[model samples]
Target: MASSTSLTLSQALLARATSLHQSSTDRVSLATFTGLKSSSTTTTTTPLLSSSRRAANRRCAALPGPARTRPGAVKAVSVETAVGQAADTALVEKSINTIRFLAIDAVEKANSGHPGLPMGCAPMGHVLYDEVMRYNPKNPYWFNRDRFVLSAGHGCMLQYALLHLAGYDSVQEEDLKSFRQWGSRTPGHPENFETPGVEVTTGPLGQGIANAVGLALAEKHLAARYNKPDNEIVDHYTYVILGDGCQMEGISNEACSLAGHWGLGKLIAFYDDNHISIDGDTEIAFTESVDKRFEGLGWHVIWVKNGNTGYDEIRAAIKEAKAVTDKPTLIKVTTTIGFGSPNKANSYSVHGSALGAKEVDATRKNLGWPFEPFHVPEDVKKHWSRHAPKGSALEAEWNAKFAEYEKKYKEEAAELKSIITGELPVGWEKALPTYTPESPADATRNLSQQCLNALAKVLPGFLGGSADLASSNMTLLKMFGDFQKDTPEERNVRFGVREHGMGAICNGIALHSPGGLIPYCATFFVFTDYMRAAIRISALSEAGVIYVMTHDSIGLGEDGPTHQPIEHIASFRAMPNILMLRPADGNETAGAYKVAVLNRKRPSILALSRQKLKQLPGTSIEGVEKGGYIISDNSSGNKPDVILIGTGSELEIAAQAAEELRKEGKAVRVVSFISWELFDEQSDAYKESVLPAAVSARVSIEAGSTFGWEKIIGSKGKAIGIDRFGASAPAGRIYKEYGLTAEAVIAAAKELS
Candidate 1:
């Protein structure tokens, strides 16, 4: 690690490129570190991978393809030289140029996208894909393949070009041409749902790095659980390329802090230190010593001064990063933003805009490239084509290794297989505890804890924690120990006071294995503001992360307005592709867990209460599944004098209101609108059965914003909610002061009737 090798420096010296002196000690000879295969057995030694793994890599040089070379080939390098000496400076330059132009040309064609990053970071991109990273482009979902995140996602062309060169079918020539277009696999940013090779949806700066931490954490946890000393199965690395913007975002610091604390050694992040943001040089607004900051954050910091062309420096940095086993590494690669463009190379003009036709011509002339747009020099193609076969062979070797491991460790293999392939146990839902009307009253957050512990017992991949609110949120998995640097296999993750990082990290965990790893994160409901971007990404990227938000409303009390989420539920309700669930009792809490577990492609937010409430009659696990169902009804013929609807802590109030109304000889139907999203998905007949369209006298009560309730309550109906901020008082007092009570519901219902 750089910290161990380098001398202690004063604050003044910390601003200097610290890794330059430290990197010299770690650089291996090109012969030993090169990506190319050596004819000389002595030169074939690679310190990065195990010798047994290297032996398994001895396979076909290329997949089956036509023998003849195409036009405009980089004839300077022969097929043998190109494949065998892929690390040769001249050949490597041509490959790097290919990546640069792919970005340049794609951006030129689209008339959009930030091109500076791809242009500057091409060397690192080329080295990673061509030399260092272990991935199967053809099988992007291969279980053991290394994960890569382009955290500076605006520079997605960098990733798109790499995917194209590495031979991902998702980014064929046509897809690159159709970049940023509707329905194109190559979107403006890397959306994992849109592109196969792209790992996570990361346009919002800082999120990808946070996600990378989660990915590394997942690797560490799984490795600890499944990797036997004799037969290691869960082993991989997570690499990320983040820019200055990511560093500027506070979320990155929060996540990186945790990454260092957790000692995610397998995570190596490449900080593209181009020093230029959209506004101009980062010095204009951001001039902090990032290396010093990261060092303080407990990361091994490395700096490659010549990122534009220092291929060996980048390689050496990566090699050194892998050697550091106690903490994550940050390789700061400083380079000119637009490396090759003569007129705009270091200027902000090239940060986002396309270098127009004349400059493109100048760039081409300068780089000595005459090929047409999207053209890959045949030598580069042939050189990169080896990865497909090599990747297949790697997966094959791993599969065989797993087969043997499975023979000896059947039970462990079954559990691991479930983690790899998203298959739940035969009756996983049955493991969720059920509660009857006779059950004691409890806070939904407490009920949620019961569900989480139960789920952890049955579901092998079920694991998560809170944003330093495990005690308040009641999200601790009682049976499991805290997941720390030493105890990686524990189900409980102590995320500290980092709500944004916690949310994004959980997104990464959920997306890591799709349906396999069901990661849940918890915090107070009001704190969603701190992590809305991450939660939104979870919705957009189809990450099934369960957000356990306690202190749902004014019911939390004393903490006052800032701590109470008046609009949180309504806001999440408006967001598409998310289930905003507010359970009233134990049965509904169990149902929320089931819904969260089953909806493997959609994220769920369970807004739980800090205050306890009674387990009301007619509130069932089955009724909660419908999102909204008649919990108590004295009405007949699907026609009631008034319909009372509520959620979370207020459902008991609505039930009480309904009882009072029913006593006055008025037909009342009390509906538990547990999840509006789920209820909207229910059949029209079922919806009508719960809240008949003919009945206009509907009264909806909730301790949230009255914003979107009009959609549920008809024109003649009323919504009783706290439109203003809550007061600092006892929970009961706050509820009474805010009129969030059965009396309010009864008044609204009678007025509507």
Candidate 2:
């Protein structure tokens, strides 16, 4: 079944086929699919469907459409078959066509979107929603159900159609009609937030696969943590359908390499080898052997010669993938882009454009689809009646299994249940470290490790690692073993040097983690550019990822300009829905971690330091939660002449500058601006209290770009920072050379005052 074929799901098929053929009062609708009909034979070679496909279609929610399909319009499998009768082949074809047409109708309605993917990949969609994956439309978050990710997310219409047909309330006909319009459930791409059954926000090429790896990782971890040998829970596969664009992206290589290295047996990716891209044929820019590449990365590769019509091959590939319980599988399925399109098949013309009304009509004729727009034939509706009920039954069975498990292992069950409900253990926050001025000065990175280790003791949901920089990044959870092939129970994950993949993988963990586990990723602050796309996805998808970025700014030293992050702080601060935190000392570091833990709807990037920092007297966890606060003010009992702001290593500089200014008989108020995004979320009155509007004399001290600081410093204030690349030297010298010092801040504050 593969270049490295190991086993097949023959036993699973026997069980699956039996359950499907069992006597049932309910029926599932079927209305669509174009078989790879051979001219040489009378027996149409219906694409081979795997065992998962029979149950797959049973779960399909049917959409009621017009009264009929075209006379002799590729006769569909009838839905009125009796029990024990091999499920109607015609019904399967009809179901496949329904999906195809639904996608076309949505794309046509939107008047925008990539129609080629939906039309071409509908068969695979049917195989997954109808046959492969298992999920209840009523409760899309069922713990043990398989997950399906559409890596080619531009064709979200396909997923939307499946959800609608599969009876998921997440996408109704009205939502489908809205298409890409504002406030629609169906956006330009599949958004997990917008749809219930949607697993992760995908579409940026290789990020989805990385996310899939994360999902599989979470499933494996949970199974190991909670599952007993007799009552197996957390058994599910993470299936991803990726296209040529996804394969071409380098992030795919990073993620897939890890997927193989980790031996994620439940990750089954379908490589949609539709050789067409936006510009033209993929051969123009992408000509590498994907199969060879995956194999080199230690993946089991399978070649499906005729994906369009070879249903048997697709089914068999999945069966074989399931049988191998050690490594991930990549099934390369070659299909024509815009399949069945008389004129545009296999061409880029069908990639992103709406097939014109004329072309649509011609195509409808070409494929024998006579139903009106958004029509789901009734026979199809009847066929899908069993999916919802079947899903409910499956969920009930799981609940019963879990009930038995809970009875035997009370503590384990309670923990698993807590995770599923997104609840932290009682008094988990008690482990956070507090600091006093007498506490020895320490690098914020070192303090960050303390917070991480402390939190690890309390929060089981908190698990993370650095991109091959766990030591330098200080992101390791002490006493926790590494998450490797053999030990999925370990909290620390070794993501190698793949920063981009690490971010994407973290997104997956956040998205699929049952109880909303907070996944964190770390690297030097300077290297964020390498993983910006994944980070952007994390923010966009609301995957509350904690990005523990150490070696912030020139303080990283000796690495020079190439490693100094001059503009990164400003760049990330400008980004929406992310906390860009640069703590001053031990207390602020704890406060930052506290805020990060509380804000589970957005991502947080802690820009920590390489140099030592003394704990400030007035810093508190409560103040950090409020976003920012005054560390020292009105010591002389008069209106402050100037307000000083600082973050990270520069906070000490600002504090020292404030001390010098206060000695000169000027009242100075020092404010710790730890998190810009969090600060912006605070009340205007709160912001004004921290930085009074009446006091125009102010200065901001930070070791990065001064771009966004103007929002706080104002026109009358000066900003002390390094706007350019730094030179090779020790941390202290680099800071001094860049003018990021107490003396420079004092001079700037004096000028402003």
Candidate 3:
């Protein structure tokens, strides 16, 4: 069979259903949930199909063309089909309510989770999981599977309920019962690491939708690079469910603008227009025309007037979204916050808090669901049971197609296989360049560009760009073109001036293939404040994104206090599972890249310099692996009288200070503390060998805040660093004025020793 994208939604559904139904020995239904149109509104429902009519339809479907339709067939078949659709609608309604009730019961059990979004968005969730998306429930990491991100992550119960129905072992019935409890797979918010089916960790509003944009970008890039006319292997859509809160966030607009500019056709977003927030109606703080704004941003916009029971309308919107192959589509689904609750529906009280016991009972009765809590009716369960086997068959069919494609296109298959399986090419690290003391001095930022270009040549997954600071950050890949709407095969991603979106989008790209896509983003070091939330998520979600931060200190000079990063380095050092590397020169810069590439489970931030620095003696890529290593030593047995430590541009100053102290016949040692986090991970023996605890005369020099230096420097030792903001002057002038110099380091060292 060909790729599913080649067929219309209805055709694909019918074909798969007929094929599966015919192959089964027992009664297996892969039937579509159809409904009758309502006279007053788009929301509608029909009764369950009668057994006889369903069997007749199945028999007719399995037969040849002439036997399937007889004389006067068009009118008769239409009438019968309409009747069957009307009957099947009841089953659809039950399935949708199953999702809503599961969410309600879970929230009521926890009494601390959000239930309104799940209750209101059940129809949307049900249609997507049961009908639209293609996936293998047993293999959540299937490369070709559609990615779904819930930007409104507080309503994660909707996803957990759907996952349970769709046969994901990660979200079983017990997991649902344990929602919001510690150690449960179902957390209060969606976390990709904790939950297998979740694509990315989402909690802060707008991040998930931005991540969806990156996911779509990855798909488009891979498809353009690997898909042949006859064999389209890399094909998938990225779907997101965002709410009013996500829209209110500026990060969402930043990412959505790029999504529209890039024309990510396979990105379809469902805007949950419930009009209710935690503080009551959205009218208090939001009243903008979201649909019109999306259209202005170049997105194809559709509005579903009623999302409560508009099952067919939701499906149709997805179909239309898939039809548009240029720009991303946004379906604004208007819904009641709590659709079935008698008193709380559409109210702020239901937005977060659980419906009390009385209200839960009232909701159950209001929806005509007479079953007990957490109960899934046999009929609804039976209808959804087909998805598991169908999903397995879909995956198996794709595997067979891939095996055939591999035979004909061996080279392309090998490359794509590495991306799919996350296997790196052998000896890829040899691509990183090494420098010697004789080499000309250059900014670590400039040196970083060399490492980036070299890595791009060897690592197929290596790709990134700057946040409109490509020149200043030195992050452009010289061999590749920009990854534009038409030129997606190129590696360089132009994220424009969107710093927060750039960081979050890279998180999505890094998390897309799990260790396969190494995405790095760049901006000025101080600008990290703009994207700190996304960066924190990167660390929390274990998205190994390389953050190329230039202008590491007061070194950028004339840009003044606002551009300088006095406390940024110290702040990131406080964050866990993040490598904060301040590479001094060429060798150290290469080493930082090595660490970033090797540590696929932890993000690495390389704080590089704007000013040129000498490629000092004894600085090596091997030494950088140790995180903190002795670059030079004139003393014996690691017992120097005065040990001076530094990182990035300040390392050069410490080395100068060590040379002067040694000339005075003082036992001096210079250490390059490139990465404090990595150094902390070292064995105590290695750390002792580098910074012996007995040496109390330790003095450190850096151009940033001295807040955390006390950990490495003894209480008696002095740290030479600027605690105040930088001034707008020449770098050398600012260095002297701020006491970030060799003289300052030497003076501090003498005072300690």
Candidate 4:
């Protein structure tokens, strides 16, 4: 068995050699240098050898490297030597090793963490941080700084190491030691809220890649909106490091396809193609040509033969990516799994587990690291500190340029500054349009259009585009210029059919821009599921993005069950810190907008109706602000025998039901519940006053599922809702078929009573 295993390994190596030879002349070659015997056959024309050589040659010709040579003649080079020694190769290598040691030590100290990635890809991280990236460490949120994302977030040690070494203010040695502990800056996974340098919270694989695309989109939007011919204020690149697991996620495919379609040239991704995953070798499941797949998505694809030490090659690939201004780029970089450990290196055993004290000591000794655990050499620390200065020079230089730009272009500079700091212009809220009962009846979508126009007039930094449903969603603000490719004057974005990308991009815009502007995106409420992941990130990041989702329910009649949202409201409300508002009338709609805009640390979704709602006589802006209000009181007494509660278009049904109940000798009260999240947030006294424990006979009516309504209406109370998906029919027919009418509400009220 041992001899057979050796023979198989030998055959594999010989095949790799032949493939490398052939790859240079004809096709792209991917060679694995894993268990090869030196005693393998030396025949030059061995099929494997010829194929490998041709493949290798083709790959070399595609990159900006030395001329192709004989397949077996390729020399193994260290990272510093690969990128160029003119930039202090020794210091760079020391910093890279420092990152590796810190990661291993921190993980070992914490007794928890995925250590394989940091150990394997330290060279890539070092190259990007010391040679390729540009940023002001003093200000991690520098407006034009390049964005870096660790898409494989379980390997957060990789990111934490870079943050600390790069001198980011939030990461420290103690933070590293406190990893995975409550209140620690270094959590098990990267969280933007917990750490200053984290671009996005990314543990659910593929999310960070989507977020990187969003960041790139934000950069493009900002550059189009704020950049002048002479001042490229918003130009910056978004870089991401991903692993095999990240590629396996479906969301990654969705995001990458959209990124490729949108032609996000500023987005560059380095795929750590380290053949190993938790399950085993990638060949066990994944075998597609990743490079070809990316090429199909319209991305510029490149490869680095030895990612573990090819720092020069990595740097050159990034530079080449930057020069291509037409599409996003992906560089496939092959690397080992656990780079330095003796027994565990290149194996899954070292993926998540910590090396024991004995093993760690041996590994450190092997690597020539003599210091104690968590101890850094003074020279190494000083070297890295010098590479990424802690001084205020970058900021000071930018301030001078800003001062000069302000002098030359005062209005533009002020607007740009306002946006960078996340401050709304004075009296911007005053421009929010108001609607009265006397106005002509129209769909809530149309009312939204007027509101958008009014807000656009006052808020110069308010930017958003819609999904393909812009016409129906009424999300367009005609007064503002359209955000088009290569157009700097336009502030309004056009996201085409990319709803998921739009949501994620809005998060990026909120993150990239300071206080001056509030980024938003619009689409049908049903489509929110497509962008739900991005919305969660917005809530998690406290990015004040507004999701204007129209076509809120079954009332979106003929579009069929697929377009109708039956359980969306309940699903959205389930998310922590997300406000879901469904307004009944124009006044309440405006109130929802007010609360949404006022919330600077939370994300809000305005679920607007496709049909017009009759203006209620008692509807007022003040009542809407309170989240829920008594639209009508019982004429018989202050205490009502039955309560009819409803939201959105269903409120009208509840109102009619209340009138009928009154005729039946019941003291009925009608309440309009617009925002459940906000209402729940109200004081208990206020809540008790609104619901009143005395009112046991309560009926809550809505066109959606009954999941969340149970909290508002107790077990004894009845809820009238469409518990299942809708069907293709006219709005009125669907309402009748689903029992969404005043009669249904009256029956439910009677049953509860």
Candidate 5:
């Protein structure tokens, strides 16, 4: 049956070629060949030269018709002719070889990089960079530029090569030479901060693919919100190149499935089917048919017989993929690893290590190339350089359209301009909801919800959603619409159950959104482990994404230790550019939101309590902004004998304990330390004034671990916190059982005194 099918496909291709080649204007009638083959066949007739002009055509015409030959033999000859013709691209052929050579030279220069991908998948990357992608080399952050992600980030050489050839400012010759070195624009992986053309930081196997989904999501949302009936302003596609390693990683599956569910038509992934992995052939572990799996996930799947020699086919497939308006497309392009390399082709040896001087010379000779190191033919460089202006022209056109849009819709235009500039709306924090001391006790999450609602009313750019816990996480803004699959105007997002994807997507949205939109994502604090890498990237890139995490500690009842967060606070605090704020009450929660919105240079995580607490008199917005402050004064005045410091729900306990200690004749001061990271950033005079060094005796109270608190509490001080995991019970009961009461704080304070 396979043989018969092949013969029939060959005959159909020959017939289509005859019809297309004879037609002028390079346009052919695709409908005339209908029913000549199976519907799966994407056969289109295009003009080809006479049989005398091509050796392959003469050979093909001389062969006997399909009916007179063995089926397998007929199919093989026809496929060879078709592949030969597909590979014959004056523009793309030279560009593909350039990509491969540049990749080889760059990696050889760096002495560290995975070279197999750049050499093997050069055709795919070449087609994408030269003909398929749309972006501005002059302005890498062009809001409507197509996003390209290298999901198999070990193949950074491939992306760097394309960026250099395409003329992005981030990848100069010096940067290429300095690859993997400290402070170089070209890092080992595609880091957005390090490279201009890079959309997200990707080195971990599966992150880039998931980040692409986020970028696609952002495009859809912006298109929905801003595009007019005539002005399709916010439309752009996201393209990703993935390999065996990316598919094997679980995060890829998680993101791909979610993208399929959302039916993101703007997302197109090209899977490089090289078969070889770092250890050897992929059959050692990954054996599933990747194309079928993606099809099962509701993606439009296309298979290219030979990616290395089928540049036109890959290009055609990508064009056809763009027409798929209902679902994202995944094209599996079968490629030989280290193509054109005589000694290392199809082997794992070429995956990481440099091809060595001798082998490199041999590979160049095999490909009929010159021997000079880092050599590039002038003609080839000129061919790729033609694409440089295409992106700039595209951006210029978009800018003209934007100018017209601004005239018609001034407010929306200004809003979008603010987002583009990464600026917050003026006086955006003035509307932050404030709570008085007499206000009723409420969970911090509820306070957060109120804050979100207030901000959403005043700040149209505040967009986010919770990870399948919107109701519980209290991340929803009633004033704004929900960002559903089709509803782009919705400000609030419903990320469903995909936590990792949500976090990465939030990063993309935050990075790509015009300066004003503060993109955020939420989930239980314990589940942040799933999205830690993405969160770290947001911090590293300084994307300013707010992470709202609830169910902060053992105070979360009955869900047990699995749901409770023990090390989450400390873990987040350790991240370099992230601000971790655990607010104590409603007012402080409002303050945290205010700070998060105003912060443009750093990302923030607002840790909120699931349980309600009294609106304390000391929980002032001004005091919270200082990161930490003396909320209560000592009765003895001149200097406190002991200082009680605490955060979140424990602050109330510390305040109560300080009152008790003062009554017992020990001068006591209570400090509301909302953010340890922020407190540490304050000047020594400010920190000493808040917690005077004269008062060496100090008691630090919190619900979590005491790992990093010693630095703040000092040698003579102690921390009153749960050193173990939490249990499943009522929050009040758990707090008492864990000795988190005011009595425990007072005892610790006395001991320190």
Candidate 6:
């Protein structure tokens, strides 16, 4: 059982079949599917062997003998086995057609769905689901299951049909009929939240491929960490079927480049190279050499000329992809948009629009399918009936193997279980290094690094890296090495400088094994503009990614206006389910980390500063958790004359201004607003206590745009912020020029009073 080389889908099946051959000695002929090579010397024995002889033969095969490593290789076949395989191949074709027409019927039923992708790519889908990929349909949460992402998610009916045929209880005929309808699991795009078998929420074109890369990275890392040479407990492949649009999007390049750089051999992608797009022909916009581009990106590329009919070529290409155990592979599958349509085969009408009732009937007639809509032939069902039981049995066998694994390595097994369940260990929060007012002031970005180091020691699920900005962003884990192709067990991931790809990859990692991995990525705060789409997907799909954004404001200084973020806070604050935390000091930074870790269904943006500030006395962890808390109470313990609200670097300005106002016998309450989203979730009593309706004389100050502050500060309040862009100068000069100072805050507070 020692794994010297990475196991592909074919090899894993062979291993399973080999194990079965040992237990069922009477069924020697059944070993043909194990990809075992037969020689002239080996003879097919009869099933009438005596029990004693059979037991000895089985025991010998089960024990270590010569290596049996040729999976999907050329093997000698007898006449009987060949005939049986021919019959099975015919059944496979029928299953493929069943997938095609089911999608067609569903799209026809829902007059607002895409049918072309499923029709053209049905053969590839069938080959992947029935002939190659491994999973337990009864339990889509299998840890070692192969992941399939439909990057061309507009073609989701293609996936839905496959899931239905593969026996997943999640997708039923009624679900298909309710496609794109309210409360149906089948949405317009393949949403991971909506569909059980869907891996990542796709439809934004290239993000799915990027998510696939992250999925493959997760498998490789876990396989390297927990997998023993003898017991490869963490093992699986990540497959994606993408279209021309996915390749056209720039994010695909950013992610695929990293995939190739990491040499993710288990990551196989099928590029459905259909020439037609929504705007007629793809030739008008996208005519680059994709094969050459993939080759340059360090991927193994193969071409299938006739994806409509070349089932054997598809199978061969997969075998070839699985053979290359050092680099990822892409199989360019050439297909017509509408494969069986009489007139609209390669036309733009087939891309998104339904093929109408007449075209559907004509296409069905041309394909010689006489069944009614949503109908599966009896032979097709009989052929596919074994898949459910087979999948369940495979899972049962793996569970038995894992029980042995747990017994031998108890501690590793416990840690792996924690990762699988995504449960933080008791007292794990103690690892978050605490700070006091007496502690030396440091940049929150630097404080974030300390948190990473502390959490790296405690949180078993914690592992991520920055987008090529780890050194400056203070995101490096001290004791861990980089998660490279050679050192996958390392906690730190190097995501190059691709912000968009980094965001999607983190999402994929969070979604991997259903939130088994707690992932975080970093970059300059302003650069969020580049990856906003992926970030939105993270919020929509509920991936709890820690976005450690540094250089949060004008405090970043001479790097200039492009690096400074003025309106960025307002932008992300507008986004739902994302915590926009701007911590003023070390303690507040630790609080942000705590929220990010605990909120398992939402992402958090920890906007850290480039400059250091004094740790204020009232800035407790409890206060920071409230999102907006009273840092300094009014001197008189009654309704304050005015309230000064601020966040990040500007909070200190508000505090200084409040002290000055208090010296003048004016009772001023300074409020530290760290996260608006977290604040909005608080009880009305809590929010009212923090910002009382009676205290209408409020003044807010931050270095960002004044767009969102009106909600916090009422009509009687004065908002002091730069509504314009910043300038290239020293940090102090920029803040002074932009009116982000204690003097300016005091003036604004006086004016409001």
**CA lDDT scores, all candidates in order:** 0.82, 0.77, 0.82, 0.73, 0.74, 0.80
Put down candidate 2 lDDT per residue, 157-265, tens digits, no spaces: 8888888888976677888888999867688998876666688898888888889989998888888888888988668789999998998888989999998888998
Root-mean-square deviation of Cα positions for candidate 4 versus the true structure, in angstroms: 14.1
User: In model 4, where do residues sit more than 4 Å from their true spots?
Assistant: 1-87, 387-391, 480-482, 488-492, 635-638, 663-666, 751-753
- Candidate 4 lDDT at 140 equals 56
**Candidate 6: tens digits of C-alpha lDDT, residues 643-697:** 9999988888999998899898888899999999889989999998889898899
C-alpha displacement of 17 in model 4, angstroms?
Answer: 54
What's the TM-score of each model vs. the native? 0.89, 0.88, 0.89, 0.85, 0.87, 0.88
Write candidate 3's Cα lDDT for 1-753 as tens digits.
433332222233333322322322122223221221112213123221110110112111111111122121111111221211222778988998899999999999998889889988988898888877887666566567889999999999999999999987677789899999987878999987677778899989999999999999999999998899999988888999999999999999999999999999999999997778888778788878787688879898766655776666576667667667899988887677778888887788988899999999888887889998899999998888877776666655566567667778988877776666566799988899989999999999999999999999988888999999999999999999999999999999999999999999999998887667899999999999999999999998888899999999998999899999999999999998899999999999999999999887789999999999999899988888889999999999788998999988988999999889988999999999998988888999999998899999999888999999999997888988889888899999998887788888888888888
lDDT of 3 at 408: 84
Q: What's the true lDDT of residue 81 in model 6?
A: 24
- Give, for candidate 5, the lowest lDDT window spanning 10 residues: 50-59
For model 6, the run of ten residues with the poorest summed lDDT: 49-58
By how many angstroms RMSD does model 5 differ from the true structure?
Answer: 12.5
Candidate 1 off by > 4 Å: 1-85
lDDT of 5 at 246: 87
Candidate 6 residue-wise lDDT at 624: 75
lDDT value for model 4: 0.73
Tens digit of per-residue lDDT, candidate 4, span 1-753: 123322332233324322322322122122121222212111111111000111322222112123233343222222322232224656666677778788889889878888788887888888787666666555455566788999988889988988887776567788888989976778899877677667777887787887788778777766766677877666778999999998887667767886787678899998887777888777777777677688888787766666666677676666566667778988777676667777677777778988778768767775667777666677767656753442234433444455556667778766776666555788876777666667666777777777777777777667787887779889887876676544535666777777776787677666655344577789999999888888998888777788999999999899999999999999988998898888887777777777887786789899899998887767766777778878887744347888899998898899998888888998888888988878887898888777888778889999999997878888789889989889999999999999989988888787777
TM-score for candidate 1, residues paired by index: 0.89
How large an RMSD does model 3 have?
10.7
Which digits, one per residue and each the tens of the lDDT, describe model 5 over residues 333-421?
76777787887877899899788878777777877667365555677677667555665556545665666677777787666665555
Model 5: residues with Cα > 4 Å off, grouped in runs: 1-91, 635-638
Clashes found in each candidate (C-alpha, N, C closer than 3 A)? 0, 35, 2, 41, 11, 0
